[model samples]
Target chain A: GESVGLHLPTLSVQEGDNSIINCAYSNSASDYFIWYKQESGKGPQFIIDIRSNMDKRQGQRVTVLLNKTVKHLSLQIAATQPGDSAVYFCAGRPNSGGYQKVTFGTGTKLQVIP
Target chain B: DAGITQSPRYKITETGRQVTLMCHQTWSHSYMFWYRQDLGHGLRLIYYSAAADITDKGEVPDGYVVSRSKTENFPLTLESATRSQTSVYFCASSSLAGGLHEQFFGPGTRLTVL
Candidate 1:
């Protein structure tokens, strides 16, 4: 299975605190990584994306860190809110523009506990 | 902002029955994708299209058929629905640009098989 997996099945964080969700991918050839947030009964929405060329990328209140050496990827959300309580998925894109092969990981349910 | 719309926000079907989920996007992004989200298993790509009449299989293309006669329309059909096919289906579209393709996803269509 050319798929990525998360280190934690679920993560619980207090409101106003930062949250970190880790993922490990087996494909060393993968060049792109993306983070997605999915609410209950909703689709996964794009969060932040990182390229193999860079180790980290930041968004509005989110950051994606990629460690190619260990095939590790992590998403950090600042000031976690109840709205952020959803499953976070990490996906990997094989090489360049061919996105049809983007494979997602077994999500990590993020619970922003108030 | 009519970005993407999914029909039959929820569907229930029996085994061996045929079901089609419709997805429409106003962006005309030139790249449309279908994915299924299950417990533990995040968003898995079922099929994708680069443009109308140009479709490609993704990681989980089995038991699924897709057609892209119009760039804004991408429909996923389960030739024979099975209990295993019960999951939330999402449709997403991205720009044709090569780098940093940020995909916008639909709300998702939940399907249950009995």
Candidate 2:
């Protein structure tokens, strides 16, 4: 019954501004978290990921922050661009005994306004 | 042609009809997964294969079947399709050597059951 969920369904932001997407997960055994970006008519692409051992991880122009205490995760994007408009999903992988599987959240639609 | 690929990008079928979605990956990854993406349900895992002839059920595996006869291919078959089964299906692959958290996804197959 554990799940990963987003705090917002849609977010609108102006160009050149920073954007943040938030997610909450209920699986306490989750050891890895990942963020994915899916453009219209395309498959989800890997963005960034963080391990439970670390609280923050940085990528090209994005950063993933994890709060294990609250079971919250966030993806931060700098200087939002039109190309950045898409749906973003957060996923968690539990360190269970069997094969490793990931649970995905509903996703948040990011709209960049030029 | 080097990455993951899916066949019959779009399909339409009537209820009770049987349909199969084909997926292939050039990376020869050890892990393959099938997931369905719906309006309010992000991506739900349907089935996964850890290796050739090795398969397991995922969160939403009912009404679906999967097989990994070879390392490069993993197909999903719906024995009897229903209107509620209509959704966009994505196939993903991850190498055991490259870490299981990062998966490469194919475009997707859009299935519509009438």
Candidate 3:
């Protein structure tokens, strides 16, 4: 079965430092990848997304890097803050039926320490 | 003001009971999706709709049914709620396109089956 997986289930980051979360996908045809943030008891929020054509995309303080060759994806957060503490998930979407249907990976919990 | 929302932030039900989770989006996107989040599994798509009156099953669709009679609403019903069905449910929506499209999620509904 084609699925997405993460390298770390939990990550502890210090305030003002940087954080990186990694994900590996099994579907080689996945053309789109995204990173999401979910706070306790809340929904997964869209952080950033990177297309297979591009290697990286940047948002406010987050960046998503996609490596189609290796079927890997990563999320990088700059100057981590306590508010940035949440569960991060990487999702992959394939071009199917004129709509890109996405599948999610097991989440990586991010804990920021002040 | 424009975002996704889920009803009944928390639900408590018994096994064999019927439960319906609601997801509403203000963006009026063309695609709406239902997903479940558990402890280790990040999120598994239960169903998705490309438009009103057109829905398709996702990775995990058993024991669940969805309907999209309107563009802004997508509801998921668990015919017979079970202990295994006790998980956080999320609603997401996206525009019609293949790559570079990101899914925005709603606050999840935590369902507990006893």
Q: What pairs collide in candidate 2?
A: none
The better-scoring model by TM-score among 1 and 3 is 1
Best by TM-score: 2
Q: Candidate 3 lDDT, tens digit per residue, B7-49? A: 9899999999999999999887889988888887868888889
Docking quality class, candidate 1: medium
DockQ (CA atoms), all models: 0.64, 0.66, 0.61
For model 1, report DockQ.
0.64
Give the residue spans of candidate 3 off by over 4 A.
A95-101, B96-100
Clashes of 2: 0
The per-residue C-alpha lDDT of model 2 at residue A42 equals 89
lDDT tens per residue, model 3, A1-114: 458999988999999999999999998888777788889888777778777899888889888888888899899999999999998988887756233356778899999999
Question: In each prediction, how many residue pairs overlap at the backbone (N, C-alpha, C within less than 3 A)?
Answer: 0, 0, 0
TM-score of each: 0.92, 0.95, 0.89
The 0-to-1 C-alpha lDDT of every candidate, in the order given, reads: 0.88, 0.91, 0.86
Candidate 2 residue spans exceeding 4 A from truth: A97-101
**What TM-score does the predicted chain A of each candidate obtain versus native chain A?**
0.94, 0.95, 0.93
**What is the TM-score of candidate 3?**
0.89
lDDT of 1 by residue, B9-106 (tens): 99999999999999999987989989888887767789989999999998799999999999999999999999999999999888888333478889
